[model samples]
Target chain A: MSSRLLSRAPQDTPGTWKSYLGLGVILLVSAFPVYWMFVIATSSDEAVMSSPPALIPGDQLMVNLREVFTMQDVFFTASLINSLIVSLAVTASTLFFCSLAGFAFAKLRFKGHNVLMFIVILTLTVPNQLGVVALFIVMGELGWNGTLLAVIAPGLVTAFGVFYMRQFIGHAIPDELVEAARIDGALTMRIYWTVVVPAIRPALAVLGLLTFVATWNDFQWPLITLNGTDYPTSMVALSDLASGNYVVYRRVLAGAFVATVPLVVLLLVGGRQLVRGIMEGALK
Target chain B: MALTDVRHARTEEPRHAPPKRQRFWLHRFDTKTFPYLMIAPFFLLFAVFGLFPLIFNAVVSLRHWHLIDKEKNGWVGLDNFTKLASDTDFWDALVNTFGIFVLSTVPQLLLALMIANLLNRKLRGATFWRIGILLPYVTPVAASSLVFAVFFSRDNGLANWFLSLVGFGQEQPLDWRAGTWSSWIAIAVMVNWKWIGYNALLYLSAMQAIPKDVYEAAAVDGAGPWRQLWQITVPMIQPVVLFTVILSTIGGLQLFTEPMLFDENPAQANGGYDHQWRTIAQLIYRVGWSDLNLGYAAAMSWALFLIILVVAGINALVTRRLGGGK
Candidate 1:
């Protein structure tokens, strides 16, 4: 399929030029808002509000950064740490639990397996937002309201992750290997840890990266669960900064830029893998 | 059949072999326990966080309780739900939510499909274009909404500047945050900008999954690219199209941050300019956090959940019919 796609590359001709032009226009329209973000981020506040509006970069970026730090104290450093810890914790825990369950559902002989799998799939449509009000009360009762754990706790056992990993492992891992390991007297956990894990490494990598990115970008749950008193994730901090009544536009932009840089870097570094994962997700 | 055979073999030799039977039972126990052990964490976590909260929220919805006045809590039965049913603000917010959902999701999906088709063509710099499109999806929502706020400002903003360039210069800049329709438009634009690319990329992936032989065969039959796209690619990716539609309905209905932040008065939980942009999620937050009416907020959340469930169900039914009744 890929080879055919590659071989069908249109030669440079008037027809090809017309296709390219059409695509170029589409790309420009799709990408303009993001470009305008960086443009305004670098422009002065006055220039941003000018009659014509600044299309060119201004020289107030440093000043804006300074103001953002002084005014919001977004605790940019702390927020970054908080985001990192929460995302990593969610990713690691999800990978561990999801893969274990996925392996069991795929390779193990267990009673009620079909029923359990059905239940997991059924929960997929139940959006997490439905439980937020109750979740808040639970957190309040547990005295975990202001902690990063509150944000990470509900996300750790995503039904999507388990279902996705099950499909991946079922398709990617061979039944013969598990049978061979069993015949060789390898324990179930040992076989899973050593054999299944290595075989499904690619799927695990995709799921892990996706979980990290989603957790990092999450807003609603964190907004409800994490009070601003202590550990503020970057999204929460950015929301507070933007909503501040006395906020300066440029500094807010700077803070926005600061918040966005890590994601950009991650995407650039893992673009191929991320794209492949998203594609696979959509296809499924 | 295999289980019966194994059971018959086990029972046949069990009269004089208690130790062997004990070992067999232990092996069976190990086999059964392994899967349970492996899958326990998810059930455990869900019980604590997902299931318990859901049931508790139902209970909370039955009471008349404010967060600040815990001792004054009283059994309200169905009063909160009845009150919300009659509330004008809730109805207005519900209307605005659906309005924005239609305005944003329909165009966003269409544009996404078109762009995906464009990207699917044999072109240079396809990788760059694909990554560039994903930029908006990855950008922080708060940041993107703030950027939109600046760009859509009534005075001295880029959108107004462009409008002026097109001979609306003498008129006043459009007050995007003022009335219901204008606020909905701004909210739609923000949503469309953020999500269109993500959907486009999703469509692109689905397009890529189509076997090239089908398209080639269509081409051989004298079909143009446009005709081939409609007759082949669209039908093949219909499942993906359904997926995106349902997913967007879910996300779009719960939208809060962009409108909440873009409201003229950010500090106020009430969406600005006569509550023009108030969405159900925002209203839930306002009732719970701002107004301190926890019971009412819980009821609103459940109401919103029911709305999502119904919308999602309708979407599923429509998509199933559209997907050739599969």
Candidate 2:
């Protein structure tokens, strides 16, 4: 990791014009669909469907936005609230439980640690969706069907989350620091809450961002569990809107833009952190 | 040294006369119990929600279980598997999955490598460009599918609209999501659009981790950028490329939301009117949920799981070869 700092762009030569042109094209293709979505969202219903498609934003933004906000069948407003609540709940539980378990696995000496850690890592290869059939039945038995808890509980602590947290805590806190706490007569939980948690805030922040975004953007399970609900999630609601009308491109685009707004805002706020987190995650 | 040895030996010896200590069960301070308790939630949940269901699915797949009617359930043994072997829809879905996986993943990886190579250059606003490219990834699948569906539509769609504007292919309109190839191509576009930049960023990061000194030394030896890329960069990032390929394999096989939502008829998770794009994941859903054939659906899931495992094994073998056969 220090190689970056050590070298500091060792080949920081001037870029040629070809590089800029190529980058410009890449950027255009990357961002154009999003820009086009914005345009269609604000375009008149007729202009949106017209041949050659509206190249620029039209003046229907206020109307379509209002329609999306008020659309009952699509349940945009209610779904947004549901998404926020469920995502926050899942994120909170994941952060707390994954970190606690990570601290124990990384720092504490205990029986079955190696075996348990192996199991955890092995579980990473088994996609959770593989167990969805059983999970569905379990939820039904627990009477968690059609509830947010179905979504929240299953995702509360993921194997990858544990692995990630363990990696982070392993690198961040040294054994000597932990031993010092032990000699100071601090209980395990006390030491964890005070010294360990504060020391690993950056890693935690990355995990928290990833967890929240993933939970927010999750679909299939939510679609299965929260199906037929007036309020499932904004993503599901967008799908609902898309499928609801025959050719309501304006309203659909409007809802899509709304669904994407939070994520875009999140990017603008913590894009660098997200990129770093993803990089760190990829390395692991 | 003598004094320290004596002290260590004295401490090593068990003390017979002990102070008052807490009880094992009631006090609960011994044997690192806290650590066990802390890690228990994940295991417990995985057991109940993950492992149990997986095992149950295995058992249930062999039985003639129906969702609505309990009396119809009976031991069917390997009937489900045998039936799936002869099932044309299953094969078609599998073919479609593989077709799309290859179609999208190949170009995506190549383009990603090219983009990574470019991004490795000294460019201004590199961060902005990188983040901007990843925007499609952050967009919810359902939302992006809607936009892509609109773009790929036959009538009033962007492709045909542009074709007409350019005075080309006006006679035969671009029906982007009708035929087998067309539907796969359209879905591939969406998949590639969502993933290419993310993959590029990954490659870029891997490239960044590669020391520039190697490139400079290669340059001193008169290697050009193109030569350096194929010889140095590609080989260095082969592991990442392999990782993404395997990951994309797993993901592409499970392709659901885009194909599910892209069709005009949302009910047709079967891909299209002709079932040209129904993925294995969607097949599982159609069999289990729509057909109410729980046993068959479970069987399909197991089948899909086995295929993924086989592919993963192949991936491991390939990885070994990549590591110089060590």
**lDDT for each of the candidates?**
0.80, 0.81
Residue B76's lDDT within candidate 1 is: 87
For all predicted structures, in order, the TM-scores are: 0.90, 0.91
Best by TM-score: 2
- Please give, as one word, the docking class of candidate 1: acceptable
Over the stretch B177-273, how does candidate 2's per-residue lDDT look in tens digits?
7889988988998899989888888888888788767765566455556766777777777777777877887887788888888878665465888
Residue pairs with backbone overlap in model 2: none
Candidate 1 structure quality by residue, lDDT tens digits, A160-223: 8898888888898889998888765467888988899998888888888788878888887787
For each candidate, what is chain B's TM-score? 0.87, 0.87
Clashing pairs in 1: none
The window of 10 residues in a row where model 1 chain B has the poorest summed lDDT is B8-17
Off by over 4 Å in 2: A1-14, B1-31, B165-167, B315-326
Q: What is the alpha-carbon lDDT of model 2 when measured against the actual structure?
A: 0.81
